[model samples]
Each structure stands twice: as C-alpha cells, then as structure tokens.
Target: MQLPAKGTPPPARDASGLATLLRTAGATDTVLAATGGWLLSERRSSPATQDGYIRDVSWWLWWIQARGMDLTDVSFIEADTYAAAMRHAGLAPGTRRRRLSACSSWYAYLQRADAAVRNPFHRMDLPKRASKPSRYLTEAQLDDLVMHAVAHQSARTAAIVAVLKATACRISELTGVQLAALGHAGDHWILTLTAKGGRPHRVVIDDDVTGPLLDAYLAERGSAPGPLFATRTGARLQRSYVQELLQRLASSAGIPDPHTLTPHAIRHSVATALLRAGEPLDVVQALLGHADPRTTQAYLHVDQLERSPAHRAGRRLAAVVARRLHSRTGTREPRPADIAQAT
Candidate 1:
C-alpha cells in the first residue's frame, strides 16, 4: 500500500485513498523497512520489533483486503462490522485486539502525516473484549522458564525474558533500558522506562532474576552506562529476535504452547500475578503504566469462589424474617430494621 506524501491531497476517500495515505506515510515495504531502521537507531523500537510492526501492518493490509472494505472510507458501522467479523472468524481475542490496534495506530499516523484528515477509529465503538485475561504463566511455570532462560548458554537471551517478565515492561521498554536510565535507591537499583505515549516510569529491580542477570551481563560487557543490552555483534537487539528467542525458551522449558508465547505475555502475566496477589487496582494500573485503571480491571475478577459471610448472613436473615411474618400475620410488611438496613 502507498502512503501519501506531505501536503498531498487526501486520497479518493476510500480504501485506496487510505492505502495512498499509508504509502505517503512511508508504511510501505521499502519505506517502512527504512523507517523501521531509522526508528531502531533512535531507539523508538528495536530492529526486531520494527519488523514485527511491519509484519503486523502487512497482515492488517491483507485483512483489510479480505474484508473488501476501504479503510480510508471506513464508517463506524463498517468498523464495527469488521470487529464482529474478526471475532466470528475465530480469531483469538488478543489477535483481534492487536489487529484493531494496528489499524487504529496506522490511521493516526496517516493523520499526522497529513495523508488523511482524521482517524475514523477515534470515535467509534468496537467489540468488547473477552472480559478476562486469556493467557498467564503460573508461578511455577514462570519460575521454570526463568531458570531455563538464565541457564541457557546465551546470558543475554535469558536476561531478556527475566527483565520483561519481572518488570512488566513492554518489549520496547525492556530493549530501551540503558545504563544511564539506572539509578540507586538508597539500598537498591532501579530501571527507568520511557514507554509509549511518552510517559516515563521506573521499574524497581527488586530481587528479581532479571536484575542480577542484567548486572552480570553489564559487567561482562564492560558495565558501561550506555546501552545495557545489545546483539552479539554489538548492535542493539531487535524485537523479532526477542520474540523468536522467547518462543525457543518456552519450547525448551516444556511449557504449554498457547499458540505463540511472546514478551507481551510477560506484561499480561505480571499484571495478572499482581491482581491475584490482591494488589490494589490502582497499584496494578501504575505498575503497568496504564493511563486508566479500568484497563487493568479487565485483568482481574473478584474471587467468586470465596463466599462472603456477611452477604450470606444478610440473605439468611431476610428469608427467616419473611417466613416469620407469614406465620405471624396474613400479610408481610417492611420491618423497621430491614428498612434501616436497606437505607
């Protein structure tokens, strides 16, 4: 697909028009590859993940075609329909979310590059998520995986997973960690992250496995304060390499294949673990650097298995009072205590 150029007139107000905008924005093969390379140099993305984003955009382009709808002219109804169709196609909830997110981001890029006037995704309703986090590594599973990753011949590969899982960092955030971003906290070290949306936060390097691995790795690599991690060739690591490495680690650890295990699962696993430990919603929200707590709420469900004694007591008392009134009188009336309780 062709992205539009600067000051180019908006495309034909259809899918092709959207494609033109994308082309203009340099989301195309040659341009996107170059753009990804540039973003890598600037540390916007690891070279590997830029490739993933490129792949994601490629699939989105294909998916757009399969649906036979013009993204440039996508209406609210059409967008909604696309979401529904994606669900009906048996796509995993996470996959659907990513595809939608990809489209949403591309559209925004189009707008910024002046390829399009506005992003249709800005104000449209879409499908509700599955109401729960789908995949999370159990504590035991996480431990085993970390152990295996750390023991792997490649210390750098192991550290990648340890850091991503322990810190709940996006792969991008993990890759962006540099020596300059680290600071001492009285008695401990901290990893600073500047995430997407330009928000900055700190990930405490608690007694987590990745922290020590990172320290050792740093020392072996000369312990500089520049890039903390990099490829064996001394170039910064890529996102695709991380994904592939994660999958290899999972396979070796005898972990169940949830289709594709990724660094992203680290984010979900950490958030789920925090919520399960009864961490406050706000705390989890901040740890994940979410702009809203509601987003984190989707990862937690109030434990229904444990019945509250107070709630059961209230129900039992109401039943008893209802039976007593029927035995004492021909009709039932609101008891004063019940009224006060309701109030």
Candidate 2:
C-alpha cells in the first residue's frame, strides 16, 4: 500500500481489495504507519484491545470490497446496514458494539488527517447487551478436568491450569508471571503477581501445587526472571498454545464441546469453589482482583445441591420455633381437666 502525497487528490476509489484503500489512505510514504502509531498511543486500551481494533478495521475494509462499494463513498446508511448484517450473522451484541467502535475510530483518524470527511459511524446506534451470569464448574467437575489435565499434559501445562484454578487469575496475568514473584517462608511458597491495571496480588501455593510448580521450573533450569511457561522452542508460550492444550485434554477426557473449556473457566471455577466453601464475599472479591464487588458477585451463585442442606436446616428450625410459640401462647391444651378441678 502506498500513501498519497500531501495535497494530492485521494486515489480513485476502488471496490475491491482493502489493502489498497488502507494504503491509499496513508498520506505519507507509509500508508498504514500513522494509523498504527495512533492506535499504539491509546492509553485507555490494552495492547490486545488495540490489536482487535486494527483487525476490525481491516475487516471493514474487506466488507466494503465484498459488497462492491467504494470506501470513500461509504455513508451512514451503509454503516447501519453493515451493523445489521453483523447482527444477522449471530454476532453477540457486545462484539458488534466493539467492531463498530473500531470502525468509528478508523474513520475518525482519516478525518483528522484530511484524508476523509465525516465518520459515518459516529451517529450509528450500537446494539444493547443483555446481562448473563458467568458459567463456573462444580468442584467435582473442576477436579476431573484438572486431574485429566495433569495426567495428559506436560508438567508446565498442568501447573498452568492448576494455578489458574487455584489463583483465580486471568490467562494473560498467569502467563506473565515472573520467577522473582515467588517468595518462601519455611515450607510455604507464596506467588505474588502484578494483576491487570497494575494491581498486586498474592496467591498461596498449596502443598499439592508446590511440588508440580517446583518440578516444572527445575526441569527447565528456570532460575531467572523470565517467562515461566515456554514453548518447545524455548520461546514465551502464546495464548493459542494454552487453548489448544485445553481442547486436547478436554477431548481426551470425553468433555463435550472441548472449546468450552477455557482459561477463564478455570478462573470461574476458583470463585465457585470459594463460594461453596462458604467463604465471605469480600474475601472472594479480593482474591478475584475485582475492582467492583458487584463483578465478583456475578460469580457467586450457589448450586442447588450445595444449598439443600441450609434449606433443610432452616425448615427444621422453623418447625421447632412454631412449636415453642404454640406452647408459650397457651395453645397447647391447658387441660380441660385442670379447669374442671379448679371449679
């Protein structure tokens, strides 16, 4: 892609090939360079989020090409139609909203550079998102999944799953753990982590996990401040690797829809386990690194099986209280015989 020179007329619009439009949109020698720079400078979003925006804009370019519409001639109606099409394709509302925002940002950049006029997407309404509770695994199911992961995966992968479940950490946070984060007090090892948004948290390593983590680190001679999980080639492990590992393990364990087994699910399992153990909400919220208690509360649902005992106990207590109240109120037979004897 080649950027047009300053004050030059925009290249004649084309209907196919987004790479061409992206190139022509560049006003300098590097057509895509400016856009990339602007995206990287955004402080509000993470690197991953910025990358998604770039991908979304790239897709919008492809959509323009597939529909035989000139990118320069895109209008508000066209943007609305595209959004509708995305919804028709079964895209989630949140996803559609994000994609629209990405497109809007791209167009806004073009307007700033005088490469384009108005962003058609500025006035477009986004889809409304419905609230859905997070899904977490039961303790038995969590045990089964973790045990299967341990048996089928390498020590590193198994430890990754274990830490994710026990620590309630995001995948990025867990994979980004540093070796120096580990501190020991006698037989106990505590792993400290810098969580998302620069929050620090500490997770106590249970006896069961300590052996696996130490063994995995030792096997690799991991004594420095480097990535704990690495690929076969000794490079930092990528997110896709963890996902594939879960899929393979789930399939082997006869778990339906292996794709459903994700790192986030492991985090959810941690909250579920804590709630089942009758841990207080504040402690769970802190352990999960939730800035808002409400976010953590979403993961605090109790299973019917877990609540049955409490429900039964309440019923029993109510019956006993009712009997006591009846006796105290003289509802119990004040023997008619006692009344007759008194007369």
Candidate 3:
C-alpha cells in the first residue's frame, strides 16, 4: 500500500494474473467462440484492450441469449433493437459504438468460416467520435467544478470529478484502481492503474486538489480490495455509470447541453490545462500516457475554440455596426453596453 514516491513507475503486472473478463463456462461448445475466447487467445490486442473487447462481446452475446436468439439468425431489427436498448440503458455514444465494433469483429470471424453468416451490425450507423472532445477546463475551472460537486453532490462524485481532471486517465484505467494501488508520498498522492497492455501506470495528483476528495470518498467506501469506485455491491463502476454521472451533474448545474460534459471531456480538460501552462508537447504526451504525441497535440486546438482571435476580431467589427445602427436611428452614440450586446 505504500509507494516510494509519486510518479514512480508501478511494478509491471503479470499477464496471467488478469481475470478473464468474459466467462465462457456457461457457453455450449458450439457457441464457445461467440463468447470471444478466440479473440482473447489470439493476443491480437493488449490485455487491457482484449479485456474491453471481451467484455463488450460478452454482453452482446448475453443479451442475445437472454432473448433466446442465435447470432447466426439475428436480423437487423434485432441488432437495431440492441443498439436502442444500449441507448436506453444510458451507454455513452462512443461506448456503444465500440461495443458494436467489438461484436462486429466476432461476427466477422464467424463469417470467415462460413460466408452465409450475416453481420446485422455491418451496416448499423453509429455516432462519429469527434477528433478531439469539445470540452476543456483550466485548472481553476476544474477546481470550481470539483467544488460544485462537493457542495451539490456526493463525496464519490467529487472524487470522480477530481480524478478525471487531475490525471486525465482513461475511464478503463480509473476503474482498475484497487485499494492497494492508492498511496500518498510527500506532497503528492499516487494512484496506480492497470494501463493499456496491462502495464502498471502511475499518476501523481496534487494534494491541493484531488487528494482530499479521493480520501473523503474512500473513507465512506470502506477498505474493500475491489475497485476504488464501485457499485453498492462492490463491483467496478461501469463506463456508462461514470458518463451518466457527469452528464447528470452538468445538467443540475445548468451547463448548456449537459451531454457534452462527458468523462472523456474531462480527460481533454487535463491535456488542455497542461499544454496551456507551457508544458512541452512530449511532457504532456507522457503524462497522458499517449503512445503518439499527435494525439496530445490535438488538445492544443481546444484553446482556439475557447478564445478565438477571429471571433474577437469579428466582435470588434460587429461593434462598428452598433455605431452605424445608432447613427441611422438619429440616436446618441452607442454606449459600451450597446457595443457589447452587438458583439
């Protein structure tokens, strides 16, 4: 439970130590492949990624089985119904799209063996993921949002907000934080996570912001070895739950289009905050655990949207129009308020 210092690389995780995310025990031999065993066994992806792929494919299979349907004969209507069902269940648009993709890959494998197997999801429409998430926050604004959660929400909500903003970790990484992975050393708090490829990644958070919020939540959550953020039954919090939590809080706080304040948006906020503070692009990429700096480079555009020089120049031009309008009306020169309103 005690780490030497913050930002220290965590011990590497053993591949065999990872639990199979999807159980194939209940599946009949004929349908075993449908549970995503081949995908997991093939090692085409990192263990963390395969975990996700299996979890998603398993859920799709489970839903179909519950409905007493077989994948071989599933129609587009049934696939469409499943997509609708995921939406109704509050799955984020991106999460739903990935889940569908994972399932489609499984079905694709099935087709290799027999060309007659139809992929209902092959033609399904999914929401496009934005090149970069639209939302970003300065450190101060992020703290204010955390304060809002503290005042208007639960300790757990505040902690969730703090973790996302401070670390910029992926949702999967956050869910992997166990009781043993949390520690404090010197002035910073250390959080160890199972990163992509099952590597143990560490994020160092300042005590000034995230430390107290996380501590408060854990005090209430108890000393269980399960996920740091868990359901009442002590299972890891699903990605959908975290997304819905942020959306709900944003709605209550009267943020315009609450759905835009997504969990991934919080990740964007961290990358933006770091870059604007004059952190090097490589440093930002390293902190965010991005394999490619180009991914981190995308965060730089967020400021243009927030403080567009073109927008400001256009506002100045619009103020000239206010003067024209006032001259036409034979009224006194436009006041500062009038110019502001025109802009």
Candidate 4:
C-alpha cells in the first residue's frame, strides 16, 4: 500500500490527530485499533506525556513514509537504520531512548489490546543514557554565574539561579513553583511542587544567601497571584526562556562552554558540592529527589579533589603520620579564603 501524501498539517492537539498520523502513514488495522481506540481512551498518563507519545510516534511514522516504506512490513535492519539516524542527528541519548520507547510502547499496547504486529524498535539497541552527569559547573563556576546574574537587572532570573543552586530542583519544578506553593516552615522556607512522578515534593529555601536573593526578586515581582518565576510581562516563565537566559548569563560570567550550563547541570553541581562537603550519600539522594539510591551514587564517581570528603578524612591520617615524624601541626583550621560561594 502506498503512504498518504502529506497535506495541510492537521490540528495536532486533538487526539484524533494521532489516528490521522497512523492512517496517513498507512498503518494496518491492528495498529490503528491499539493506538487510536485503546490507548487514547484507556491510557493513564499526564496530558503532557500523552501528547509526547503521539508527537514522538508521529516522527517515526513520518520517517517511515518518507522512505516509501510499509510500516507493518518494516524489517529489523530498517529499525537499526532509523536508530542510527537518530544518533547521527545529534539527539541526546535520553531523547533517542524516549522516542524509541514511545513508539515501542504503541506496539506493546497493540498486543495488550489482543492485536499482534511486529515491533521494529523492540530488538534494536537504543542509545545508552549517561551513567553520570556528562558536564556540570564547579561550585566556583556556580558562584561566578550567580554573581553575573546579581550584576544584571533581571531579579527574576537571579532568583531562579539561586533557587536551583540551593534546592537542586529540576527546571520544571522551578518553573512550576507558584506563589501559593511558597510558605515559611520554621528555620527554612518551603516550596511545594509536584515531583517527577506527580508526587508532592517540597524544596527547602535556606542558607541565607538564596533566601535573600529570592526575597529581593519577590519584592520586585510583588504579591502577584501567579508563578514565583515569571517573565517581565508577568506571564509564567517557560523552559525555553530559562535556557536562553542561561546562554546570556554564561556568556557574561565568562564560563567556558556556556551551552553546557543548564538548570539540570545546576542540580548536578549542587549534588556534587553537597557530597564534597561530607554530606551522606543517602541524604544527597533525598535532596535531589531521586527515588532510587543507586541513581544518586553515580555522583560518587566524580573525581575526588582536595575539597572532597575523602580528602578531608585524609587530614586526620596526615596528622597521625605527622605525629610519627615528631613534627608539630597547626592547632586550628585556617580561615576559608572565600565565603561567597553559597549554594
């Protein structure tokens, strides 16, 4: 069967658009039943996740049709080729994996709906997610970045940076924080946000530094009943805006490889910094909101330095060795050279 010719783009947000995409790609009866009939009506996912599945499946369908191929007759070799193309396009591993999973899920659902069709993506070797943060700012670099934000005039932007540093919250959490979600909780101010799995998560606003920065930002933002982080016109802050803001901040901060700095990287930086400060691995896990302890352990692989907890532990070992040498050591710790680096 020939693929349907591309026409004027259909209205996408509608659920029927997904069925249209499958029909246009020449999907067989069973496939259509699984996606358009069962999944749309039965699947329990957030609206965003549901839309993402449709959107991702649309790309695969388009690619298949572009090759003048039959979707139901796709062979394993063709699946590998598509996976390779995704890599060659420079999509991140997580992105590639998610897209493949999205399409693969449709095939899985087809079987659950008592229909069988070949899952081209099921056997293909998808991209491997990075075991640890591939890139992140050092604590020193974080200070420099925040300093640049302070010098700039955007109070909202500065508070966003400060909160990310202090709480290690995800960008979505940062953007989702409402004025109503923020409240005082004893020594620390608390922010309530929905976590990754639609769970209630509270981020602590502490350390004096971040709290004060947010205070100034909130003063300027006024007691508005909206998102704590918003644009100049008072609309909710979008992720794209935060990304572009960082690009500008990184340039101003003189940070190397400005594009590498992201809100998630700030999360990684704080996790690493906390681990470096002798914070327990499990505590850091809780701070970052990783439900799995092993996920947080990945930060332990970060290269140890003079500032590492292990290095600090070694100071006592060094003192023992010094006593063996009959040499006196300094009685007190030296004053820290920099106290401005708060996160």
Best by lDDT: 4
Please count the clashing residue pairs in each candidate, in the order shown.
13, 0, 0, 0
Residue 112 of model 4 has an lDDT of 73
Cα lDDT listed for each candidate: 0.65, 0.68, 0.71, 0.74
Error of 1 at 180 (Å): 1.9
**Alpha-carbon shift of residue 288 in model 2 (angstroms):** 2.5
Kindly list the per-residue Cα lDDT of model 2 for residues 53-77, writing each as its tens digit.
6656766675676677656557898
Stretches of candidate 2 exceeding 4 Å from the true structure: 1-21, 26-38, 41-45, 64-74, 88-94, 105-117, 130-134, 148-153, 176-212, 221-226, 250-259, 302-343
Distance (Å) between predicted and true CA of 88, model 1?
13
lDDT tens digits, residue span 1-343, model 3: 1112323321222222112322222333344444344455453345567656655665666566567775566788888888888777666788779878877777776666453258878878885774644765567766667778989998988998888887889988887678788877676678887766666677897778688888899899999788889889999888888889888877776566777777778888888888988999998887788878897898999676769788988677766866776766755656656665655
Order the candidates by lDDT, highest first — what do you get? 4, 3, 2, 1
**Which runs in model 4 stand beyond 4 Å of their true positions?**
1-20, 23-51, 65-78, 84-94, 130-133, 184-188, 223-225, 304-343
1 against 2, candidate with superior lDDT: 2
Q: What is the C-alpha RMSD of each candidate to the true structure, in Å?
A: 12.1, 11.6, 10.6, 8.4
How do the residues 140-220 of candidate 4 rate in per-residue lDDT, one tens digit apiece?
988888888988847777888888888888887778778899887887789887666556688788757788898898898
Model 3 spans > 4 angstroms off: 1-48, 55-133, 137-140, 184-187, 306-309, 325-343
TM-score of 3: 0.63
Local error of candidate 3 at residue 314 (angstroms): 1.9
Clashing pairs in 2: none
lDDT for predicted candidate 1 compared with the true structure: 0.65
C-alpha lDDT (0 to 100) for residue 35 of candidate 4: 77
